[model samples]
Target: MKITQIEIYAIHLPLIEPFIISYDRYDTMPSIIVKMTTDTGVIGYGESVPDDHVTGESWESTYAVLKHQLAPAVIGQNPMEFEKIHEVMNKVIRDVPAAKAAIDIACFDIAGKTLQVPVYQLIGGRFHKKFPITHVLSIGSPEKMANEAAEHVEMGYRSFKMKVGTEVMKDVERIKAVRERVGADIAIRVDVNQGWVNASTTLRGLRAMRDLDIDWLEQPVKADDIDAMVEIKSKADVSLMIDEGLHGVKEMREIIAKRAADKVNIKLMKCGGIYPAMKLAVMAEMAGIECQVGSMVESSVGSAAGFHVAFSKKNMTSVELTGPLKFSKDIGDLHYEVPFIELNEKPGLGVTVDEAILEELCKFKDVVKEG
Candidate 1:
């Protein structure tokens, strides 16, 4: 079916809680919602969260670009031409990756519904029904972060990804203190959000935390410096996962081929959507590298979409589906009440959005070619 219309919404919603990562604090999701309508009357929904610091995409810029530029490119194209659409959108627009990702996912959802199958099954059948989620504790004092880690552990979470960037000593000290409280059995992953100035500093901090047993050091240095990344990966004994470095499938392959990283963290918003994320997952798997799926602290819409990717990939490693937990308040009750979601017998992605929550949480709605 042809995609007849593209709907773009500028959603302004407050975060239930302020989420502090390495670079900055996010008071709201500051995301753009994309809706694509097909000639056959199928509808698909997608969302993109732009990282002002990391991705350089803002709400006004994404809305203007999508409405003025990208939307016209695929107006009459086949709805399933995600790859072609992706290429056209990228070539036309400069670097609106987050906006591109929203459209990509909307198209995928449409294709999945058109075929009467879930998005995961469309990619390849099923992988696993349920995935164990990891919690991302916001950046705070060492004791506060540690206490938060301990609290999540009490709630049955086995993995925790903490934000570390501001003060290197504090970041290292927090890990050490938290590890002391949580003990050796629990997995502790650290994301620096590209805080290190150089590889030497990254190595120095990593060296200090060596005995604390960090599960993985994420994007410790800048994303562009492949030389530094590969070098860091080679020298460090700890596992290294690249986040900001992933520009596209080719870069991911290059890193994996060169052993630039021990693991790869694929985010739906960052990679432009599920199409590339799944491709990266399969590619990483073939090359004997492990990939973990994460998100941009979006609402249930984005989180649910990510769950499908994480759940459907068998070669998938640990899941970083922490948005639901990171948010002070989540929009929907849909995640909790789904059939076959009991880790078995789940036929599809195992998620459906709650209409009431959608109405309540959304500050504004953008409808394209509304029926």
Candidate 2:
């Protein structure tokens, strides 16, 4: 059936705890929710979190593209024709992968609902019913971060990713404290978020942490500096994972060719959606690179979309789908219990919106249709 109407909503979801990374601090989740209704009466839902620093998208930009640009492109098209939809979406807009991702997820949801199967099954069938998750310890003082790590460990989380790259000495202290508190078996990962500059500096910092047994380091240098990344990766004592550096399969291939990183972090918003994300996962796997599935700190809708990709893929070595866990009021029915999520049997994403919160928090809502 063809898409009859598309609804877009802008809402700000308060975070359970204000979190800080290398780049900035976030106390709320800014989301653009996309809902598509088909002629057969099946409804599909999707969510997009706009981060100006990460995806180069803001709330106004995401809303404008979805309404003025992407809407007319696929208004009356069949959701099953997702390739055609993606083509039109790209043709109408240049960058704004987050906006395209929202539409892409909604289309996937529609297709899965029509077929009476989970979105993971639609991708490649289920590889595992429950996926492992990694809890994040926001950037803080050494003692505070270490204490947070201990709390998460006590709560049954075996893997933890800490925001680092502010100061080499502080980072070293932070990791050492956490590792010492949690003992040797716990896995600790760090995301620099492009804070460390140049190969020399990155190498120096990584060298300092060499004895700490850090599992992986993410995006130590600026995203576009492939040569610097290559040099740093070669000199680094720990395995390096590229985040902002690789966008999709094309970037993944280039990074692989350059031997820039040991692994790659895949996010639904960065690559557009589940379809392209799956392709990227396979590409990384074939290239002998491990993949980490993450998010832009969105709600359960977007988290569920990420879970589908992570669940269906075998090479995803790490998961940080802690978006729902971060927010105090998640706008969906999906349940999250730290490191593990039990996927429901319902078709599509299997997440229903919390209408009460939607009405209270939604700033804008609009329906798009064919002209």
Residue-by-residue lDDT tens digits, candidate 1, 26-62: 7777777776788898877777888876667887887
Winning candidate number (TM-score): 2
Off by over 4 Å in 1: 328-371
lDDT (Cα, 0-100) at 241 in candidate 1: 85
Reference-based TM-score, model 1 = 0.90
Q: Residue-pair clashes per candidate, as listed?
A: 1, 0
> To one decimal, what is the Cα RMSD in angstroms of model 1 from the true structure?
3.0
Query: After superposition, which runs of candidate 2 have C-alpha atoms over 4 Å from their true positions?
Result: none
